[model samples]
Target: MTDPVHIVCPHCEAVNRLARERLNDTPVCGKCAKELFVGAPIDVNTARFNKHIERNDIPVLVDFWAEWCGPCKMMAPAYLQAARRLEPRVRLLKVDTEHLQDLAARYNIRSIPTLALFRNGREVARQPGAMDVNGIVSWVDALMRHA
Candidate 1:
């Protein structure tokens, strides 16, 4: 069997240890007893963002956006659909740049609708723009394959 991996619960911010293979089996958090993944992006502020990025053994994909951004709004549904496909393997998240300006500045996110991929608590890839579900899936798939 593969090693157990750490997964941060989306519901209650609890950290759970789960077998790597069981990630596809709909695991629940040990603390909150809630399903760890719900097939959608989790909206996080700076504090919660750090916990997920640093504690999750899986990779994370973050959409840095603002409420006023038209492109960000247009891409929201596509991002949610992409999350449905990418979850359990990757933790998908959305951070509002307007509210969490520190996170945006920390990541040097000069544009809204930017996508950042993080692995082992560090950013590994970034894309700036809006994309369809297929494009989002393809981009993440290619990167994860190479990684």
Candidate 2:
């Protein structure tokens, strides 16, 4: 039997086991009938953010931003584009700094737009500033390679 790998369903928050070979392919959740990797940023509140970080076996790239921040607005589309490209390899997540002030404070996020990469529920890298699609992809690729 192949070793089981844990993956959290972005649609329904259900944890499921999948073979390592299936990581690059399309994955469907047994409970929710949704694709496990949808190539979109998943909006997560404080509680759900903690849960996802703790439970997911894949690397998570979280965008910490606010609704009113100009830089955040400018980078939104780029972030989404990067998410679409990086799907199945990295789980993209978004945390609204306005709604989750405590979380923002916990992470010591003083900037309006910050990107943090987490693996195994630990922060491996972070950057502050708005990045274009190419920049985002390059950053993640570099980080993952180094990791």
Candidate 3:
């Protein structure tokens, strides 16, 4: 049997130990009784962001953006669509740089609409730019497959 992995609930920020094979089976949170994978990016503040990043056994994809960034707005829909495709495998999160300046600085986010992929609590890859749905999905898939 495969080892169980830790999943941080997007809704309640609760931790759940689930079999790796069951990730795609519409898992729910033990604490909140809410679906773990909501098919959308969870908007995270500093506290929740740290929890998800440091605790989740699975990989995390983070979109660092500001409200005033035009490219960030342009890529929002693509990021949403990518969330639908990547959830249950990757935890998608959005951090608003305006609200969480510390996080942005910590990550060295020199550009808006930056996408960072974290695995095992470390950043594995980063892409800075706006991308369509296909580009977003393909970029993540390629990185994951080779990483």
Best by TM-score: 1
What TM-score, over all chains together, does every model reach?
0.99, 0.95, 0.98
lDDT of each: 0.96, 0.91, 0.95
Q: Which segments of model 1 are wrong by more than 4 Å?
A: none
- What's the true lDDT of residue 67 in model 1? 95
Residues 1-147, model 1: lDDT tens digits: 999899999999999998899999999989989899999999998889999999999999999999999999999999999999998899999999999999999999998899999999999999999999999999999999999
**Over the stretch 1-147, how does candidate 2's per-residue lDDT look in tens digits?**
467678888878888889878887798997998999888899998878987798888899999999999999999999999999988888899999999999899999989799999999999999999999999999999998988
How far off is residue 145 in model 1, in Å?
A: 0.9
**lDDT (Cα, 0-100) at 97 in candidate 2:** 91
Q: Is candidate 2 or 3 superior in lDDT? A: 3
* Candidate 2 lDDT for residue 93: 95
Best by lDDT: 1
Instruction: Name the lDDT value of residue 13 in candidate 1.
Output: 95
* Poorest lDDT segment (10 consecutive residues) of candidate 3: 136-145
Which residue pairs clash within candidate 2? none
